[model samples]
Target: GTRGPLAGIRNLGATCYINSLVQSLFMTPEFRAHILQWRFEPQQRHAMNLAYQLQMLFKRMAHPSRGFVDAKAFVDSFGMGTAAYRQQHDVQELNRQLLDVVQTFIDKAGTEQVLKRLYEGQFYDYKRCKRCGSVTATPSPYQDLSVAIQEISNLPQALKAFTTPDEIDGVSCDTCNDKTTVEKGLTYRTFPQVLTIQLRRIDYNRTTFERERVRQDVHLPLDVDVSELIEKSVVGSPNASDDQDENRFELQTVIAHSGTAYFGHYYAFTRVKRVERDAAVEAKRLEEGEDATEATVGGEWIKFNDERVTVATPEEVEEYIDPASWKRRHVVHATKKKAAEKTKRDAEKKKEADNNDSNNVNDGGDAPKDATEPVTDVATTTTEGAANATPSGNAGMGTPVATDEAFAFGADLFDNTGAGGGGDSDAVAEKSVSGSSYYAIYRRVDLPLPSATIDTASLDVPEYVLEATKTEDDELSRDAAELASLRSVVSVGLVYRGKKHWVSCKPETTLHELTSTARQVFGIEDTLHLRLRAFSATMSVLGATYPADFTMADTGATPGSSFTLLGVEATTDAAIAKDVWPTQSITEWDRLMPIRVYQPEKETFAYLRDLV
Candidate 1:
């Protein structure tokens, strides 16, 4: 095959559904090599081994003419035969079966446990007695996790709900020897090189006796921190420091379903990156460098949509999981807006051109020969419109459209400055990096230094600025005041659906009050519970949890320091975020929201169909 990256595979009937997944695995260089190199000694009659078949299938897909072939033998190997093969099969089911065959057949690290080493994470299952305070910890390993997407959630929220402690209904403590209440929770102990999570999208409605699909969006952050969920983490306590490794994961890929559950198609977006040693340092350089000495080179993002492969530009990647961004209505709205703007521009240009012609005729043979004179278009433009309007003179002079400012994503979505710096910013330009020799030891805290504060309000204007920028400075000052208010109050930073938001409140504020503010922000219908999340190593913060009565002061975090607020459902254990036991419900709330749980192994999407 010609090198660089392999071409998209052609579909072979319904077999192409699995081909989408196969293509996803093909892109993963490490896993691809691991599977390809694994030897399966047993030969099953005239048919090829599953590994060999997958190897051959990928090999064929790599070619141009023979892009893909029907996997008649591969499907037959499942043993369900034509009956199951002819009918539609769940993608999750196929994924589980495929992985099971490989994992079971290929025991490369017989004693070491190859599959677990690569995909599994061990958890300490804790059961604590209420009477004696005695705790029992059981080490259980889980290869994959299926997170229930309660309301609208992101990756971290789903994970927190999964790893958060659950209540053991009825269990007797061994030490106490009494059938009293016991609190159960899962503490993350060990993780893998590659972590795979399935967002449970299929929900069964008992009333209708039908499976419903949840199309709510979940945003994936650039970095995912699983440290606070780990049992050894001290973030929820008073002594949680900033030194612990959070086991942060940089999101490399996202496989998304774009349509309804029954008729939906699957596509994937992938960013080429690896977890760097230092997150802070890595955050500084989000793009690859040109230096050959660089250990890793990346930054390109590609969209794999079945046989249609294309570059997913930066803006497309930024709104990867935004539900609104993907809707056809959004596209229509943008199209109409552009059409209106063009219509207006065309009318104005016609008027301007007519005026220019009239002026030439009025002063016949007296007009200047130089065509570089200021045009009537600029003279007629409003202050606000002039700031955004393209220089009509450039078009008149026959300048190329490639260098046009009208095409940038302050208006032109494609005008991307790499993750590191800006296209026109002085800081990104050629400059020396030197700290002042005038370092000061302040006895007391001081205001922010001018050099340290970013002048984000400045526009690179060429003397012909619309306004004096005094209004912008005033706006920045107002924003600074607002930020100060956010810090001084309860100063809670709510992390939900993979986004962080800060809001101001009081220490005496009730859980309902905090959640009420959060609900308004997220526009969610479910009752939200505010739990104390670990202080991010990236930010100094407070720890706050529940008794439903405990105040923010109960966590012992200082005022004015930001607190981490994690949004959870009131139906789930409200105190799970703080690793505490929740009080019992008076009535059966399970009927309120009937949860259908299904798990078939790691890398498999959990569907209610698998259960029923």
Candidate 2:
């Protein structure tokens, strides 16, 4: 939805499923960059020419040209259905085919190819026999890992579930040379530069004999450790100076499927990494002699729904994955408080005025009009026909009533319309309501705002010393705000899951307050775990915690600078700061093994997530 030329893809029927797959791959910056450089050096790059077609199609997709790129050739190569029929295709099926194309393309281009550098990974296969207890090991190459979802709620749990060993009976073992009980295990031998974890949401139902889809919400973390899944052990230091043995992965693009197996829609939410750029240029404005504003750019997450693209917040992206999280938090509005106060004050003032007027007499029925009164109390009617007609009830409603201030105040409140309406008339006969003197009475009726009291009970302060502690805390909060206002302000954006979002904040705000504010903004109560990532003009900082002691102004972030607010699990009951459970090194796996994905040559997801 931002300022960009958007491109649309023609539905072409059930092709929407595959369209989601294509869009997901196209948005991966490294992969797109590799495809853009396709020279087709090898003519038979992947025998079916799948890679060449993909490069051409993706290039067109990235182009700013208006019309939909012809994806017919690319879709046809998959052999899902008749070209003319245009039947629906499964996303995972198309996903595997696309990987095969890339893998073969890399093979044809040899070891030095772009696809090979990005997609190739080594995996180890281990099988152990119960008879002799000898384990056999083998290695194989992979473009991606298809991990079963297993109905787990999070990525770490799903990967853990996937790595569980399978038991097989009556299997011939090389060591035993006879049929025996054996266990088969698959673990990561190496990690690809662009590691893709396919959530196997589709599974077979034994009773129904049909492919069933899983709709349960599954959570993914911003940081995940797959080192436990590695078959080999770290040859060097586990926590090396470079920290590669950690083998952590950051979420990049998510291809979310929203429908059942028979019918569904596909869209993607992608993380746009930061790059060094000037705000003046990105904003398309640069005043002469204006100081240049530099920034760590691309801290935004955008959603691609077919051709329609829009910016999304971290909360929105989370809600997209899990529908239950979509409920928004109720807001505490300051205006509503003011309105409530005004209402109460007016009601009290009205009661007081009513009591003051109750003791006066109404001339025992009808009285002669006073001469000095510029406004009339009743219709002339020859002075009410000299009271010849019947005298109406003095206290009756809808009668022309006069306030004591007809002459004392002004004529504006008299409702001096051509028709002799009273001062309380709905219509203003002479002066408009704005110019009327009624506001004078309104000012008199308004009472002062009452002093606010600190809720000691909520603070759990004992009644004996409640007054003493409440006074101290309240004074500190007020004085802190005033002092913080003296410093310059820093604007921050919340970065969570796979997205970065903008949030407004005052200058001199500290991280502890920031966390509380974010909780309110996102409608979270109780425990909220948030970490701030600050970006400077040239680079971004990592691991900034929000403590009450430090203010954002202390971090040296620019006014228009971007920050990433990463959401973490809120822990209770003995939470360790680092090297804790789940994230603790290599213990969760059934079998201990070395981390295999550490390589300085290829950049991993961990490096990208922390990219300055």
- Please write out the lDDT profile of model 2 over residues 274-319, one tens digit for every residue: 3344545633422221222212112355565666656645444544
Worst 10 residues of 1 by lDDT: 436-445
Itemize residue pairs with steric clashes in candidate 2: 232-594, 233-594, 234-594, 417-429, 489-507, 495-565
lDDT of each: 0.50, 0.50
Off by over 4 Å in 1: 1-4, 40-48, 62-72, 83-86, 108-112, 168-170, 233-246, 273-298, 315-319, 322-612
Colliding residue pairs in candidate 1? 165-185, 408-412, 409-412
Error of 2 at 577 (Å): 78
Local accuracy of candidate 1 as per-residue lDDT tens digits, 203-268? 788998887776555655556666666655312222222333326555556666544445445556
lDDT of 2 at 530: 45
Mark the regions of model 2 whose C-alpha exceeds 4 Å error after superposition.
1-6, 40-49, 65-70, 76-85, 102-111, 129-133, 168-181, 233-246, 274-299, 320-612
